[model samples]
Target: MAGFLVSCQSDARNATRIPPTPSEKLKSNWQKDAIDALTNNIRRKIDLDNSYFKRARIYFENEQYDLAINDINDAIENKDNVGDYYLLRGQVNRELNNLDAALQDAQRAEALQQVSPELYILMADILQEKKRFREAQNYLNRSLQMAPYDGSAYYVKGMLQSRIGDTTASLGSFKQAIDLNPRLLRAYQQNIIINNRLGNLNNALYYNNLALKRYPKDAILHFERGQFYNALNKSDSALLSYNKAAALDPKLTEAYFQSGSIYLKWKMHDAALKAFEKVKNNQAEYPQINYLIGVTLERMGYDDRASEFYKMELEKSPENQLAYAGVVRLQRREMGQYSTPSAREPAQPSAPTRILDTNRVQIRTIQPRRSIDMGTDTTRKVIIR
Candidate 1:
């Protein structure tokens, strides 16, 4: 697994205070004239601050997370008391993988809006990232209490429960979210995964079907349904689902790989070769494709060709069990024995014939050893001569 870490700097300064709404115009006029002499200098600073925040929003929306963080840092340094500003900064920080900084900024936002469910949700997101499931649950619960109708809160809680392996609770939370709003995509995916884990394949198929209905072009949904069918040993259905997924999105490598495996099992060698060939071309570094190619070749009785592919797989993964097993099988077939020891065993003579042509027959009795050391470092001696 790769570790993603990010650093962030936040400004803790408060924004310039604004006068009460009733006196705002009068106070603005009174201050405007007096501050007019220094207006140009102050205006430049204010404009710079505004530009910083504007650029921050643009960068964030454009997914330039590092640039967004820098611009937001400048904006926060100028004035940190803006609740929305802190919220935006926290969002950028989270995108940058600076969960600690994100948590702090989110907490600051919460301080500004003490009962804001959005702030609590942000905090819960950070807690969940840190794997503090209990704390995350508390924050999510608080957010739900503040706004019971927030379907997103339920969805998030469901995700948190799923992470902690609490499938039952997760199912309830997902269903609640779905009940509130049927369009929660994350809930649908999570529900499917949880249902599959719980051996409720029928429910998984149903939810996956529903997800496909909503997201007709979603390759993942088709791929997941294909996997469920494959698990049930319904290869034809699995093949159709995989074909649909692959047709919708040719880049879905798992769909191709799985379909290839199914084709291989069914002895549809040509189809298996084609699927694995695509995987090889698209994802050359994947060792499994090489192993599969070797298997297909072995099935076709091309021992030499199969051996080459198996060797290629071993080059990528020295301890490749399938590659080694292929090598062993091929060697056995080539040498006409499963192992070298059996091939080297001396042939025994037919049972002594009891006939007049034998004239006189001398019988010798042989005794077997108590044990044999199949090979490496031991000896066995029989008492009989």
Candidate 2:
């Protein structure tokens, strides 16, 4: 019986394992499906990451900065390993004017890629906007070190130099940027301003004219031209330029103010009054506008109207010298002192004069002429009748 039991055990052991039955096969198939689902889920996660980044880029390019930020935020939250995720988030934050947040993200990106000049440039721009000139300069220098031929970095450095009152350096930087990329409009504009500040009107005009050639309808360029012309004392040309600027942009208060000032200086009271009136109606809080109106009115001999405007100006700016001067002049006029005839006699006609000699010219007749008799021993005085 034991031998028979051992033989049966051996047979059982040696028996071929049956292929999976239909139900078992179904179970096996189910297991395989589960494994495949898991594999697909992993791939989907990866695809989601890629898709988010792609969509975020699209949003950023379309100027939907908020959406881009949200998408990038999700991507980073899901997996913070991607350096580009942080970099893109930083760009979105910058577009939204969230400089602090942008700086933090950009710094993270810089940590991930030590040699990224683009990141340093972005940081430099934010620092520049915050007026952190020294810091901005340092970052710009770093960016330049990494990418020696970066036109944008040079342009930004130029602007930073200008803000810090380093004109020579600023000019060199701007020129370098222009040489690298001539399409930089801002560099051209700043170059003009620097030239103007240095009293290089010809260069200023030349560059300004160059800018105008590029942007013919730019009101700011025309306004700048007007300023240059005014500096040259070319009032007519200045007025024409100012008029063109004002016509191009009616809401430019400075242009109107400048036009009014030019007219006032030229004693074109009517035109000045019109310009000042526009300013008063458009921007009444401008104390100088009120003062200018008063001045123009006074010039036109409208004392009462001028006084009213002057008082209004004083109400706005109590210490305004122009308003006070206008008021004082108006008061003097009202008191009849400024315009009244002189009370002192018109000088009595001077006695007629005649040339007595080539060497001496004297009055021909006088109330009395006293002379001394030199020949007489006794001192004698003779009155020439």
For each of the candidates, the C-alpha root-mean-square deviation to the true structure, in angstroms, is 20.1, 22.0
Candidate 2 Cα misplacement greater than 4 A, ranges: 1-116, 129-138, 159-166, 319-325, 328-385
Screening candidate 2 with a backbone cut-off below 3 angstroms (N, C-alpha, C), the clashing residue pairs are none
TM-score of each: 0.58, 0.58
Residue 133 of model 1, lDDT score: 83
* TM accuracy, model 2: 0.58
For candidate 1, write residues 185-221 as lDDT tens digits: 7779989988998899999999999888878887899
| Model 1 TM-score, all chains together | 0.58
